[model samples]
Target: MWAVASLLPARRMLASAPRGDGRPVMLLPGLVNSDRSLFLMRRYLRRLGYDAVGWGLGRNLGARAIGGEGERLLARVARLHEESGQTVTLVGVSLGGIMARFVAHRLPEAVREVITISSPYAGDPRATRVWRMFERLTGERIDAEGVVARRVEIARPLPVPATAIWSRSDGLVNGLICRDPEEDGCRAIEVRSGHLGVQIRPAVLRTVADILAVPGQGPLGTFRP
Candidate 1:
């Protein structure tokens, strides 16, 4: 997928990708992933004229890393918003997207938009293949107070624009769990890629770029499969 995506030069073909506004973008990597994993996505956003920045909080340690207002993840987001002088567009991949939803819910004023890629935030955690691994990593069982409460919290609508990008081909998380709630400000876009490929696939990149270029509530534009 990466090789084929590289050959497409999709960025060049995406004439509408350029925002020209230089909005600040914060990318959160998936579970067990770090800023390094999002290098390609962030670089692409930067090239399209957005101030794309990584979470910079090291590998995402699941609930423990972003479970509370006083955690490292929140602190980093606060610092970025303060320094950027702009509302940030939070973009997260897989588990990182779930974290982004939590951040957006907590600090809506600091976030302009929230985008999640293949994140299973709205359904049974057991539906995901990684739930057991997630439990081991975060030490928080699916039924635990904090984890359950957080699931409910993230499922609520964000005050900012929200987009959920899901793929039927995803093998990690159930695609249905990635759907946007029945709310006016939120929308879901379906892509043709695997869970990980959603990050680097050219079509997915074009879709993301197009979404970011739009100004208001989204599903702003559509892309071909």
Candidate 2:
């Protein structure tokens, strides 16, 4: 539904939106999804003049997918930082967003900021519709001691700038848990979208581009168009 709605409108939105500074932007896909899931978004960001790329680690299967302790993902960020000579911006969707937060927390210096779409890092994992699937795929129980500790770590305030784009109507996860209300460093943007729709929604794409265009601004800073 959102993919169809975003087709023409997304093009128009990008046409008039502000361009980027050629900084490297990495798009992370959700669980059970690969870079193919974010192809359109990556193309859109590229058209907006940013050096956008995928996580390059294939599908997101939690820590096991990125190497235990997220070493592989961290190495990817470091490599992008070295090659681009600038910090990288991470845009993650669903489970991808959780991984993005983990990476940002582990290596703040290499990251410019993080933008999450319908990611439920701040809430209980069991609140999501996919928790069982997550456990099956990752071989880690949601209620495990390590998993709970990791969640707390990721939910902590990030050292770098952060933004969370979520939808209350998201059917897969409880939307309220997507953003931490007490985290002043993390900006929250509410949009009308379902769990999957948030990724392709025209308004969400525009918001992301706008955020990327301006740096070191408050959450309510004017969007460039």
Candidate 3:
């Protein structure tokens, strides 16, 4: 099933793979998304002097019931590490950001840097009455307190350079979920976008490209205007 589903992205990506070797980058899609959802971005990254890979993990339906997904993420990074001498940089969107963080935690040796797009790292499942309804309708199992506490723990002295790319216009997850951390490895950046567009927004695309361009810098580089 996924083999056929992967065709479109593969064809789309092939049109731009010649420039794809120096660095290794992995684009991890958001909730309920498959590797196909990140096709375009992967293609662009591959075109930008990087060997880009899709998470290929089917979907990012929050961490529940299913156990060991974190281990799977680490395995993926390890695979990439074996192929390339350096660690892989992660670019995750929404819930995938959480997965990326978890992966970095278990396999810091395999991760060079991490960047999250519009993820609710701070937690805001009940920031607004509307969100409760949103959760009910979407079946988002968000235990804000649990998520926040867990994230805070993962956040202390983050293992790699990390950046949270957020937008005030994000509607799904509360925009305020974007946070600033004084830890040298973590930084928060603000963009103008809606949650769903975080992956395709033009400004974001440019930012992602520029971030990938820095030398000796992981996916998260010094903030640029």
Go through the candidates in order and give each one's C-alpha lDDT.
0.81, 0.85, 0.67
Per-residue lDDT tens digits for candidate 2, residues 108-176, read: 999999998899999888888999999999888988888888899999988888988877888999988
- Models, CA RMSD each: 2.2, 2.3, 6.4
Question: What's the true lDDT of residue 109 in model 2?
Answer: 93
**Residue pairs in candidate 2 whose N, alpha carbon or C atoms collide under 3 angstroms:** none
Which number leads on lDDT? 2
Ranking by lDDT: 2, 1, 3
Candidate 2 colliding pairs, count: 0
For candidate 2, the lDDT comes to 0.85
**At residue 11, what lDDT does model 2 achieve?**
77
Error of 3 at 176 (Å): 2.6
Stronger candidate by TM-score (1 vs 3)? 1
Query: What would the per-residue lDDT of candidate 3 be over residues 165-212, giving only the tens digit for each residue?
Result: 887778877766654555566767777777765686555665676565
Q: Candidate 1 overall Cα lDDT vs. reference? A: 0.81
**How many clashes show up per model?**
0, 0, 0
Put down candidate 1 lDDT per residue, 87-171, tens digits, no spaces: 8888899998988889888888889898888999989999889999998987779898877888899999878888888887788
- Lowest lDDT sum, 10 consecutive residues, model 3, at 215-224
Off by over 4 Å in 3: 1-21, 64-66, 128-149, 215-225
Candidate 1 vs candidate 2: the lDDT winner is: 2
TM-score, model 1 to reference: 0.91
Kindly indicate the candidate among 1 and 2 with the higher TM-score. 2
- TM-scores of the models, in the given order? 0.91, 0.94, 0.75
